[model samples]
Target: MMVRTVLLAGCVSFFWTGPVQAGMPSVSLDLTDIAQLRLQSISFFLMVLLLSALILKLCWNLLAKDFPKLPRISYKGALGVSVLWGLMFLFVLTMISGARELLTPGAWEKSGRTYRLVEDKQPDDASLAAETTLDERRRKLGELRSALFMHVATHQGKFPGKADETTFAKEFWLQPGPLQARYGYVAGDKQADPSEPLAFEQAIYGDDQQLILFTDGAIKVLPTTKAQDVLNGK
Candidate 1:
């Protein structure tokens, strides 16, 4: 009866999570984030496991005999314990699985959108620092576009002149920028055609697919050599 009750409660939890997850997609967790998540999951698991075991033992001692000693022995109480623990077990298992997916590359793709945008490929010299820098740079570059557009709107359709990350940061009220801009900047006023000139670069890192933000707010990823040509007015 205990096993049957536990299985029924487990099914209910699976149903609950499935619909909730369907309505709200999973967001990938970072390594640091998942570390905390796993700790919580383990604590939850242990609490439920111990509670269920204790309840089952108590129920056996009180009610599992031809002539039970305890008059207060109730099947309902054992059923409640089984159900509660089963639900808890399902929840903890789901959390652990989600955390594992977030920490594992290629695994996050299945889970949903990653918290940190991951590079398509790891560079030959890629390390934790490189990946962290690259992710920060990518996010900053996207954010910088908004500030640049605001500048253009206010300044006769011209972007800020020769600006760096700090300049855009100031423009956007971010105070000090999250990180220095990897790319150089050219004013939007200089170019008539939106696609003609390089607005900014990833010159510092010198990576292929250097992020090139355009005067028209369109961004392109280009190789370093081709990006140099564009910057040189080739």
Candidate 2:
């Protein structure tokens, strides 16, 4: 009975905790595409650390029972530990460098945008900085969109009748999703053009449904059927 109770408690805790990420769609940052690259870099480094630790732990478990108290650990064991440590240190250093670069004006902003306005310009530190500014603007736009969505829900008792970059930037900067112009919502016939990737939805992020736009120009629909497994992406 005690074992069963503990199991039930564990299950409950696992199923009900943390941020309410339920019914949230996975939004891919498409604008700059560089943000995706940055994410990939971070993800790969984390994977290396996690995989190394898991392999080392398993090896230690398997070898511990067979080996007696030894004066020295194997070279392979030391190498494995060193590799993990080195990867972690490298990741930290990379993050510090990236943060420094982003702190510069227009560097972080250039990260997210649908198109590069400076395609003709030669690639340089300044050009890259400009791209970062665009990226930051895009993110701010997304935040503002989300906030406007909630406001529309609260005051109007529904989503906005129409959404544009201008109206959002003008109002609710102090409230949710406040930023410079970035997010865009098209309504009616404007969204009817199938040649374009656009949709007029009552809400971008909803209780039962969440809409996510990827830089790849794909829209993903995420359902919150099981709240515990929400937003993880199938």
Candidate 3:
């Protein structure tokens, strides 16, 4: 009976209980520290309780011969105790699984398991805002270029004489915005070869950092002098 009990326990332990891991090397974990996470919610806790109870009852029946002197335990009471044990285990598992997160005063403990940042770093709003604005400007310019390309495709091979400010996202057309002001439009019925032609460019960035869009569907950043030379038939 004892041999069978030992064999049964060994099999269950080998198959069921698995290893649990925590965080990176930077985050330390210990057994006794309070877990900062909720391992099981209400529904999951109920499920685990019922499953633990079933296993406990099965084990009790199987090991009855080994412990013939043991007092009889009602299945209901044994199941209730098993559920309580599961709740305690759920709480401990959280402690073993430490988090690599920002530490706050309310949750921070002076124990070896708890870690905190020495300094607080804030974002650079000025640079972030500048980057966001630049991205928006770039998108607007691309949209305008696309609309002009579509116009030329169906308008007998001629680029739009003027950018329509009121043109917007009605369906296939992209909207034009104030960014169009940077572009110096050329007035002509049609240019036989617009392959190397300069449609418009942005001079807002810098004299040497101008974003120029070409007629050949190529966009490049060039110096103001070179771009002006291209415009002047250089």
* Strongest candidate by TM-score: 1
Which candidate, 1 or 3, would have the higher lDDT against the true structure?
Answer: 1
Off by over 4 Å in 2: 1-31, 68-84, 87-234
List, in order, the clash count of every candidate structure.
1, 19, 0
Each prediction's RMSD over C-alphas, in Å, is: 25.2, 31.8, 22.2
TM-score of each: 0.36, 0.22, 0.34
C-alpha displacement of 181 in model 2, angstroms? 69
lDDT of 3: 0.59
Off by over 4 Å in 3: 1-138, 164-182, 192-194
> Looking at candidate 1, what is the lDDT of residue 153?
70
Give per-residue CA lDDT, model 3, range 169-213, as digits (tens).
Answer: 533232233322445555555454646654555454432555556
lDDT of 1 by residue, 117-147 (tens): 4457744533332444555555666677777
**Local distance difference test, candidate 1:** 0.62
TM-score of 3: 0.34
Residue 38 shift from truth in candidate 3, angstroms: 64
Model 2 weakest lDDT span, ten residues long = 174-183
lDDT score, residue 230, model 1? 82
Question: Which candidate wins on lDDT?
Answer: 1
